[model samples]
Target: MSDQSALQAVIFDWAGTILDHGSRAPMGAFVKAFAAFGVNISIADARGPMGMAKRDHIRMVGQAPAVAASWEQKYGRPFGEADIDALFAAFEPLNVASVRDHADFIPGALETIAQLKARGLRIGATTGYTRPIMEELMPLAAARGYTPEITVCAGDLAAGRPSPLMMWHAMAQMGIWPAHTVVKVDDTLPGIGEGVAAGTWTVGVTLSGNMVGLSAEELAALPEAERSRLRAPAEAAMYAAGADIVIDSVADLPGAIERISASLKAGKRPGYR
Candidate 1:
């Protein structure tokens, strides 16, 4: 294989991609944070902006048509930056507190990390989570043996996912270059878009991430057909978001990597039709 085709790094997203099955931490926090403002947001509403910076996420949620209507009716004003700030302030501590409780590693995460490390692949991470939130979750993840060489959080950069900046920062900090030589694994549309914008191959995980909203045990209890039925929309959305591949979880990542390696060897870029 040519050097250009040899993958060097894997940049993972936090929350859904690594810890937090169903990416439950932030969703609950988002719902409660909005509720605190007397504006109720459903889980689907919170999940809509899953992979962006928290402030951006809050802004998007506030600007959602239904949410905006509720905000106007309740407060007699349009949702604006001040509203975003207030919501974010409310969200911060709730997210920070909840992240620790949800920091259990996704199934196969440890094994995948070990395999990637064994293959000498560099490990780095990016997240929509802010530093304070990560500060709480990282130690717990570390205790479970899943520390990445670097973690780039939401506020660490001037911008976050779907912008390519955070992913670029993670790669730059790790001294890994030529973005195509890295693969990004994430579960959210913005997360996939980040990889695509960064010029790396992108893989999206559906069932284990926000798409299915089921824990490992919960998912295991479902029949295969039921699981597939639930996962279809996320899978389609991932492809629509320009993911090169989509899998049920990180458990299937190695096989996806093999397929991506073959494409790399064939001189294909991400999102190749």
Candidate 2:
């Protein structure tokens, strides 16, 4: 769209964008595991680090002594190796089952990606889920017939979202330069920030199954102004991380392209206010 040289690739985020995973699964799993250990945590507490790697998520939860203490006080049992092991074990099966059985491709996702690919744009994806999880889902995705040119998974790399590692790695593997030719789309602040830090054009998508992970009905019930607030966190985070623009959804992407192209055509620096 820009200098032709300025926009050669597009990187997408998985999870909420490509898959329709309801909040019930993760929230229920966390509550059950914490309950077994005699602790209680709200879904809000659990949502704080949605874009972090699995191990980091676990470590973050463990760092809260009060949460661990609540579990110990309730069950008269410590959150020792056994509890941690069981938690991880249960986490995989519960989530994988959903991916294998209940996974719904997001509305318009397949079509939008196909359209972008048809335009000769290189495509890739980055996810906070581990390599094993990705492996389990790949065949399913292949069966569904949507393939990304590259996929950067959690444990495959040393760090996760909020860090530019996964995105930078994906770009390198795809042979795309960050500054002149890439766009990154994501649903979370950390993921958006990662793309911005990598100096790629970053787009933020906001909707029901993200951030707070609200239900569609619940989201729809909210006033339009309240619903608009959903995109603020991503926009602020991306702007701080140096994003050029933040769009509300993937459907708005063509306009985003036009804006960036116009700027580049006008010889402005490749960023926005």
Using lDDT as the measure, which candidate wins?
A: 1
lDDT of 2: 0.68
Tens digits of per-residue lDDT for model 2, 81-106: 66666666666665666556535566
Q: Candidate 1 overall Cα lDDT vs. reference?
A: 0.90
State the lDDT of candidate 1 residue by residue for 51-145, as single tens digits.
89999999998999999999999999899998888889999999999987898888888898888888888899999999999899999998988
Task: Superpose all Cα atoms of candidate 1 onto the true structure and report the RMSD in Å to 1 decimal.
Answer: 1.4
Each prediction's TM-score versus the true structure: 0.97, 0.81
List candidate 1 stretches off by more than 4 Å: none
Show the lowest summed lDDT stretch of 10 residues, model 2. 20-29
RMSD of each: 1.4, 3.5
Error of 1 at 30 (Å): 0.4
Clashing pairs in 1: none
- On the 0 to 100 scale, the lDDT of residue 176 in model 1 is 85
